[model samples]
Target chain A: MTARRPYAGLIVAEVISDAADDALVLAAGMTGRILADLGADVVRRRGRDRGFERSTELFLSRGKTMSNESTGELLGRADVALVDGAVLRERGRAGLPSVSAVLSLFGGALAESDRPASAFTAAASAGLLAMVGDPQREPLRLGGHQEAFALGLSAYGGVAAALASARPHGVPVTIRASLLETLVWLNWKAVPLEGYDALPSRTGAAAEWQVLRCADGYAVLVYQEPDWPRLKAALAEPALDEPRFATRGNRLDHLAELAAVIERRFLTLTRREIHALARQHRLPLGPVWSPAEAFGEPHNQARGLFEPLGVDPGVQAPRLPLVWLDQAPARQAKIAVGAA
Target chain B: MKLLEGCRVLDLGIITAGAATAALLADFGAEVIKVESPTYRDPFRAWSAQDEPDAMPPLFRATNRNKRAISIDLKRPEGQAIFLRLVRRADVVVENFRRGVMEGLGLGFARLREANPDIVLASISSQGETGPDAGHVSYGSTLEALSGLAWVTGYQGGKPEVSGRDVNYPDQIVALFAAGAIATALRSVRKGEGGSHLDLSQRDLAAFMIGDRFAAASQGEIVTRQGNAQHHYPLQDCFLATDGIWIALSVPASALPLLSDGLAVGDSDRPDGLRKAVAAATAARSAGEAVSFFVALGVPAAIVNDGNGMMADWGEAWDHALQRDEQGLIVKGFPLQVDEAPLAIERPAPQVGAQTCAVLAEIAGYSSSEIADFAAAGIIETAR
Candidate 1:
């Protein structure tokens, strides 16, 4: 038989928070979901009145069992616990498991501040809001609940490391992960580069790589220095042969004109055609596919990348993004969410 | 005590995805030795500052701190022998080269397991190690485009937008997840399981981040770009204030009454009307005043901070994500802090081959004369 999943016998407790912030709930719920996917027994404790969007609930509550056990009782039996700052403070260190990851809005010096915050506000504070979109317009937040989910990723890493080193009856450890810290960590390039006085900002039309309109939808024009020759050959337009677009520096100096020349060629081709050309030339071009359209993509279908949600057979989510080469491919047993 | 005090890792990682993962392991107290070749240094070392050869680029310094550096030309048989010797002493090896580079160098998983049966080899790539498009060339935004993230991330009815070269979202998050997977594999090794190869794909991870959208779409739900309008929030977007600063505000349904009373708008029941009223009210006051007002009333609001504004709120909003080193140079910091065994920057980034002599003598069991011979034969490099 194949070796057991990594954390098969591990038990995790996910504490619920009554606060109305979506970020906190998502972070805690996501941490539990990751451990559950790794074969851990995750028990999600529910408060009487807390509610989440149906999609969020369906994605996060997979492979988890709803529990009515008190926080203290759950901690007593759990090998690990995922909690928010408020819950951690409410229960104190005495009632926590040997390994506990505390999710908070702000950590370190501002750990106790009760300022109202959401994923949007956290993104704004972390300088992530200033990185995307048109420079002339207001900066845009990323597509989904990225800030909260990133915090969940950080917490999971810390918990995994702690679990790797934990002894049978070792001293307890508290892992602190926060929304602001996690966002900043992801956007670390926003911090001024060493020896540079000015910080990097959004480049809009000036960026070397950009999404241009195609016959169907949109496709990003992407190519590194080495792929420049192939990109020019694929487009096969005379304007690209202009002296002004001879080198990377020259092309940057006339980025808009260069984009116009390429986009003129792209507007006639569909996204699939562009993708096929990229594959042929070994270029890094990417065609933007809506979630609905992505379901039918040949690559995704071939990889079997998505799995159906247990609660609703019609719904599906991406499987865990890792594959162990040594083990046989075995589907995870789907556990339905039940009432506490 | 440090969490991973006794763990030894041979870092064959380069650039953001691989190097940053090793850096996190270093932060957790693992002994991570960064390996490069004299002819092939980490491209990040010259990413920016081509004009001044001696100056370390910010990206390189930020991702490579807290580890010692050694140079080995793995292409040569002698160099491969030395690397296998080091591998024998190491518990893990991490790399993110294009799909077949390691195999071409003859240091593939089979060879690594031959050197040490319990070694954990983490192969991080743009696609997976065994897919039809496994050899596809990609950057972070390219993966974002292919992974269905950019599709849902834009103004309503507008074209999709990437985080661009500056933010490269996939490269950053993959490091976090890859490090965790390595740790889990280490746990398995400690439990007597044999060696394993971890296949981590950035494109797959980018899709996983937006997994809920996929779930909805697979169920025949039309999951199009909704901009900043989340279903749970009545109104959420950025508005420019009188002082010329943009303020992001999110209003929950429960706060509709309070928001209507505060802004004196009778049309708060409608989402569009509430958004217009909030925009109008925000445009009449300074960003700080508007943020404070909404926050006091239990609404989520904040000023959209640029880099400088982020530095201004460093201590209060966040403290350790970006930190100052011994010489007051800014470096990458931790995403999480352990209360008992807090992570820290023990040393700054090293020069190429900075610890070659010491590592060869101490860990690889090479004597001083053998190291001298290797240097003479051009198989290894020592820091000048």
Candidate 2:
């Protein structure tokens, strides 16, 4: 049986946002291809000029059919339309009477509606708060392209919402997504928690919850309220008997002292030995794994989590993070899509 | 207010990395029909409370809400036949297998395109499907290391600490990108263009998170571990409140003068006074009051609320979590507008192969005898 078609094979024309970054345009094009995979009959639209990267075919045109036409011509057969950066900037400012026009030998009549349009910007609503004022004086650049990516995510939601809302309103639904908005939302929600500005600080062997430099390798030591007694008993540390080191609050207040005590206890223990002890105590524990360590980890292997790929027919790439019922993505397809 | 009321997606993926992508798709009103195996189901089906042998896991429920699940053994020629039919009707197929696994099973892009040339196919991977490192093995943690995120996420004078107890940050990043890409692609398709292939690497997605660090490194800057210490703003960091919980405070540099005048705890020249004053103020007030004081002044501040805090907040202001069972096994759902649509929560995650027989009968147009034979031959698992 075939999957249910959400829309009756209504021919639709799709257009992407032409922005400064080719990465986004390429990514958007690839995403369009994925949407086609979901059942939208898709066609690829190119910009007026080529980008700095000649690899648009490899990146964006993968899994998609190519097409060339003016925006006006494409819009005629389009029942659904996907638009990007150009819509939000000039059209809104210029105050166009209608967002779209009809193609005609002799103009019969034009149909238009002004119901609200759903827009998805890579930026979240919250992310926008940072860039409210001036780009020059108080410019807010995110630490990364997360803002842009988030906008992309929001755009997906906005497109669906707009499409959903439009049917009832009898209007041609258009969705707006921006990179700026997604970042704003993520920032507002997760706001770098503290020192999020700089490169995340690098911690070496010792973590807040686990110790890494014991034995030749590293070990994860987990301690919570339930496991503290077992840890104290295992280490035979008398300081654990002290009132100030007994409760969660007491231990936190005197964290430095407690850390020292725990360090002293761990000094004589090997990583393997400690891991065994942790297991016996039912504490959450593991090893500080490098890629090599991960390859040999029994738990991971048992889970059948690894999915190996062939970069070339002879050359083996690393195992991937996903496994599709003992299957991997098609490498030949990647080549066909011009990924290489 | 189904956000994606008219959107449709064919989810040809499994487990967390791909499930996360589909789950996010389901959150917005995209009709996602998840293709699972008849034998094992998705791996998540077996992951549940250890005590409840037949129940689906909470982790699966958290990510797989609001989507239909179907079972088909793609290895069987008939199963491949069924999938091609579905492909002809699908708008998107998001799969994150290693590499070449799809082709080996005869379910490659060629087969998919044969059914529908206009289909958009997104093959998510640990590395990518191409390049020298295309075949590298990865989990969320491994991706973190390759992307240099794990390189810089730890306390001062310590080795890199791995993050995430169960969920991987890279997986979420991929899902976010996938969702965004599909939205843009739909726009293109509407404009009479074919959808494009999105080649997103978990490594690249992870690297994007630390772009600032890479920029700094390009300029030959070495950043050392400072824990929660901020560079420019003296007192901008997570500090211990009186209640012993961590509170993140972002005091503007311009507020240094005001802070000095109000607190009177530090000297004008002693830069350490800022830390001292914050420490003092934090110690004097309760966590709530201290947060309120800073919040009212336009200072960005928040409590480092743990799982318990999360639960409490969910119960109070939003009631964001819903109990899936009588025993109060809860699943998290999306919270949009206060009075929009009633939350759409489905049954908890499926037990492995729990829906195999039903799915085969309904989606695959298979009879009971056929399903029984497949189950008997170890090709599939039967629900009953």
Candidate 3:
């Protein structure tokens, strides 16, 4: 039998909020658990007597190592320190000691502090301390679970980037792909030059240039003006010649009318029937598949995009961020702390 | 100084996919030289930007920060020659056209490998280059829907609501991952092992983000929508405070009493006690106050903030924000701090073809006359 090789390992100091909400705990716990799953050594320094359920270990923490040491004690030995300043203060600790890096898991005044004192030593913020809070809401607090996850992710990214640049012989770098920045970057921003602050709008289920639903499933499709004539012929919809539906513009202006026409046309046949129609016309269309549906899709299964993990029998995770090297197991269990 | 102070990247990307990857590299201190076609400028110059032809577009500026740009139309034989020359001297090349586009342009891997076998090439596309769907065209939205992310984004009782108007943002996230991967690959190449082509599909990666749910779905378990309702605890959800602020709370089952006692609400034993207590407590206090009080008690909670506020706080409190140039471009700098030295922001984003003449003259050893002739032949577009 082959011995299992751990992928990553590190200890961490985590601070929780007093009278905190459930979301924050789940967020912090889940984040730590996921890292542990990825083979990292994860220890929770719960200074204020907070306990994590073993059930969460089954579901979220997986194979991670857990502890109830003071934040100060954990910080001295940790490679990464995730601090919820609100949680630290709840224990009535005056301040937190600094470590190599501090991930501000929440926002506000503690988020405002560069240095954190805990059961560990006094942290002077020698490393790249990053602050990430969820900015989707009107006003934000620290340790909003999902937002804390966002900050933790950004912290992960910053750490990854920082390490990438540390070695003397490799391409060096510093990263700033923050969660908040990521949100802004993701947003369809208003055009700066013209003050147009929107990207496109949502038009549901109408495959203007995508898949359309049929009786059984869906078929992906595309429509350029060249394809329009072929599509009209295939659907046998003479109404396309009508003034309101003739040009792309007129049809776009009255998408509701066009959608109604297409939906009614689609309802007449099964997914196979639509696939045949689309294929014969050489339209760009595919079936609308759920992840479950995708698992069974002949094409997906054939392409080697799914890999099974032992965590769940008959459960295969999608392979992505595809690497040329042999696939490593997805970070499944927490690495043992202080283990080689 | 930034950690990547002396590193140089040769960028052959256009539009969102490849360019965004290169942009991130530039953000991290890699000197990215954006290679473009002298004849047809970056189409994003026309379509994506809010600026006129003569001005820089905000889309371009946002992503293209801290990099130099030069025009060399690889389709033209001379342009290909110049780009190959640059590749031999660069650390990486990022491109996102269809699979055969680079090969068709005559600057394919074989030709470039002849110049520098170790030069890293990152091929970003809708689907991977060798896959069946490699030829497919994808913007962000279509890619999102195809990946099953959009299928899971809506409310419990409603159809999945896609956020934002464009393709899902996972495209950029994938792009970031690709950048990180290529950078990691470059490390291998520098050790004399040679570079490897990274085949990253946006669809494949975005699917991984929702891996936990997918793991269950594979085994006949369907995870449904709950609209901010947590699976573990009932009260762990986003709530609307009286100030019209949305605050998210995550308290353990044991801390329920602490919350009840602090807010002067009924104990957790009451039928609707925890819910009513939480609502009243949050309502009576400002979002910030509620957050502060909770933090003092060692609970898990946070308030959602906006962009300006986030940037503002980083600028003011956290010393993480980079200083911008007069043009408001984030100056190039070291992203990480070492031994209390603040990361330095060195240079701002460059203009189109800003260093064409200088780079060609200094690095490529092209004389003024040859450069002028190449310029006349439309081989390289000069800076305005």
Candidate 4:
């Protein structure tokens, strides 16, 4: 196990954020979390209260080793330093190690000083909001600091690439991941209706695909063109037998009628019933569970997605989403890393 | 040299989740070849609407750039043999299929390891492998709802909401997470360790965002949505300006007068009044301008911008990345930059099977006669 862990005990100096000198973005913080999840000894300076809410700290600070050391002392011994571009410009990359890898999210392309604070506004400013959600209404942001999630992911990939490229030799390298650019990259992927000049307005909220109320809660139902025959079979309703529901465009045209018919049918079933039907029909439909209710989910339970956090018996550590076969230090990684 | 210059990746990803993962590796200088079959082409590949002769869709081009394309039919033994040989030479294989689909097709991790003892097989799925929901079908929106993102996203009083359009954030999350996982696995291999399967769950990951809700709920706190607010702080909120622009401010009301000299709340202690006053103040300027002003003054401010406003904020960089194709259609490039070293786009997305013969010959060491014979035997498609 010791032989397998090239990542084990890698000291990552995280130049953390605080309220007095707030220099953190949710996306950028999430980037640090990504490295921590891979078992880095993340050291954030203990400072005045963090600029973010306790929730942000709890989410970002989990799995990190907080410290009171000066940033200089920490970075001197650290293998990786996660910093935003502004920090690099101000501090210069002089103190970074010969083998050090720096994962950075650039300051705003417009005003370098204008670091984004909200995932919603950042996403919107990136043109991501423009292409997402209902086209008629103001662009809809997904629930939570999603911009953090987006940039954090790119940061995670950048850090991972940096880690993989790390060597006993070579000059320090800086990997730059963009927040606004990442948002732009993700928001428009489909063939834009407006061609390349601009992102076409998203269609209205009411589409062929949506969440419908079930007996217990809500369930998302994907009644696409491919699933029409099987969906009609599962709905087993004569109301949907109309010629209006035949083609994709017609189905969109009569989406209300179709939704009403499906909603009524769905109302009679629990989320479990819909899951079963979805599997049988090969359609993309499933229940929508709240975070609390997710604990009872059979699949999550089986996968051991959540581990006990030790503070409370009822509380569990967030289930890690990525399993590394490299740092076979983890229980799952031993078998996952093929040497078995 | 680029970080992953020597790495080779076989991407059997379908949606944004898989292509985006491969795209990351490609951007970092890995040789990532997209493996798809005409019979099972990626669902997102229908990017171009009209028959424009392989004019890639915007989404497809954005996520699938920096990699070559090849098609292989795993259903047929000959194709599987070719793919297995590719796996032997490949360092990483990434696929977004639901659990057991690969095993069912004899391309599961166990089989890949048999072919190459040091190959990392990353299975990117909505629910991870081995769970009851592992076999369940899910899209990004459904995952959003189930993962608790929907429950926490809407306004303080509004019901749980999803994207109005099918904009799934979890898919992108899975892509990056998987890419990182693959890179991690690659590091172990670089150090002479064996490769293993990476089981990444997008559903579990997206749900992890609302982990704070779990802590709050566990403490017997009834957590509801905050909309543009946080922890029920009256001052931390988003308001629509008189001119119809939206901006979010996280500062308390007490600091407002000091932050902006002209604005005065005048005992607007009530939440509604404060909101109204803030709205009035913001309405005087454009959303982008207000954001810049507040940011300059050390207040966290952001305007709710769309595609147009986004370009306005990040103009030159955005303009440089978003280029015009031969048809003058705006196309985008990879956003991640590695200083002065060029992260080369080896080629545009290959037409399915366009590189079948070439990849098989170059990577799999298949002879021309063997490739021609395989094509003759109906095991591979060498043309569109």
Candidate 4 residue spans exceeding 4 A from truth = A1-6, A17-25, A51-55, A98-111, A114-117, A130-139, A166-168, A190-205, A324-340, B51-54, B232-255, B259-261, B283-302, B314-332, B340-346
lDDT of 1 by residue, B170-273 (tens): 99999999999898877767656666889889988888888888888877788877777777787888889999999988787777898888877887777777
Highest DockQ model number: 1
- lDDT order, best first, reads 1, 4, 3, 2
Query: By TM-score, highest first, what's the ranking?
Result: 1, 4, 3, 2
Q: Assess each model's interface with DockQ, reporting 2 decimals per model.
A: 0.48, 0.05, 0.16, 0.41
Comparing 1 and 3 on lDDT, the stronger one: 1
TM-score of each: 0.96, 0.57, 0.72, 0.89
**CAPRI class of candidate 1:** acceptable
Which has the higher TM-score value, candidate number 2 or candidate number 3? 3
Cα-lDDT of candidate 3:
0.52
Q: Residue B255 in candidate 2 has what lDDT?
A: 54
Clashing pairs in 4: A19-A51, A27-A148, A124-B305, A143-B153, A189-B59, B47-B57
Candidate 4 lDDT by residue in tens digits, B1-384: 787777899999886888888887887888888998747887777755545765566567656767788877789888898899999999899898767778888887778888887788888888777777777777787787777777776546655566644456677667767777788877776556677778788888887766666655555566656655554234655556556777666554435555545455565455566666666767777776776666665556676665565555555334233444445545555555565344555556556776888898999998999988988877887865
lDDT (tens digit, per residue) of candidate 2 on B84-188: 766766767888877777788897766776776556677788766655445544456556554555545544554544443222456655776665455544443
- The candidate maximizing TM-score is 1
Residue-level lDDT of model 2, residues A16-38, one tens digit each, is: 54432332443344334334534
Give the runs in model 3 whose Cα sits over 4 Å from its true position: A1-101, A106-153, A166-194, A197-214, A217-288, A311-313, A325-340, B48-53, B236-255, B258-325, B328-349
Off by over 4 Å in 2: A1-340, B1-3, B156-158, B223-226, B229-234, B265-270, B315-328, B335-343, B346-382
